[model samples]
Target: MSTCPTCSKPATADFAPFCSERCRHIDLNRWFTGAYAVPAVELDDVDFEEAESATTPPKSDDFNA
Candidate 1:
């Protein structure tokens, strides 16, 4: 018998490749909720922080003005 990708249990005929409906649903939920995420690395610490700060824009200074 083949193993279930989600729970690693033995696959069942009823669930086909998956061990059970629960495992299948869990896998689906993971995809839907973005639980299966890929990690991204900061190529350069200084440039990455600068890019993040620039994209956030600056707070208004109207009160002082």
Candidate 2:
């Protein structure tokens, strides 16, 4: 028998790929809540911090340049 992807239990006929309805629901919840997110690969040339800073308004520097 194949193991369940979520809980590592022997898959049941009722659940087929999943061991139980609970495991199925857990997997579904993960998808719904974005818990099972795929990692995004950032390019070496991409400056994420700079991009964010540009979008935000600059704070007043009254003391010095």
Candidate 3:
């Protein structure tokens, strides 16, 4: 049997990943209250042009040799 994601108890078919309605509600409440969050990178810390430049090699100085 699959374990509950919120409480680690045996999961119920009704809730699939959760053991019961209570655990499912608890998980939903966390999302509503911002207890769970997705991480984001600040744009200020990233330089798109600089990142592009790093992936590209500098132009060769000599056409041959």
Candidate 4:
């Protein structure tokens, strides 16, 4: 049997990595309360404009819409 991630008890097949439904709820509560998060770097407007300019095609005066 696999060890439970929350309480280190022997894992049940229903919960897989966690020991019981209670442990699963506890883990969920942690996430809800901001205990877990993916790291990110905020981008600036200059970065967005630069990327947009590089990828976007130039507007043509001759082509009629």
lDDT per prediction? 0.88, 0.88, 0.88, 0.89
Question: What's the CA RMSD for each of the models?
Answer: 8.1, 9.8, 5.9, 4.2
lDDT of 4: 0.89
**Candidate 3's error at 16, in angstroms?**
1.0
Model 4 Cα displacement at 36 (Å)? 0.8
What are the clash counts of all predictions, listed in order? 0, 0, 0, 0
lDDT of 3 by residue, 1-65 (tens): 88999999999998988999999999999999999999976555358677777898767864455
User: Candidate 4 deviates by what RMSD?
Assistant: 4.2
Tens digit of per-residue lDDT, candidate 2, span 1-65 = 89999989999999989999999999999999999898997845458777776797766884467
Better by lDDT, candidate 4 or 2: 4
Candidate 3 structure, TM-score to reference: 0.65
Runs with alpha carbons beyond 4 Å of true place in candidate 3? 45-65
Candidate 1 weakest ten by summed lDDT: 56-65
Q: List the residue pairs that clash in candidate 2.
A: none
Task: Report the CA-based lDDT of candidate 1 relative to the real structure.
Answer: 0.88
Worst 10 residues of 3 by lDDT: 41-50
Badly placed stretches (over 4 Å) of model 2 are 38-65
Top candidate when judged by lDDT against the true structure: 4
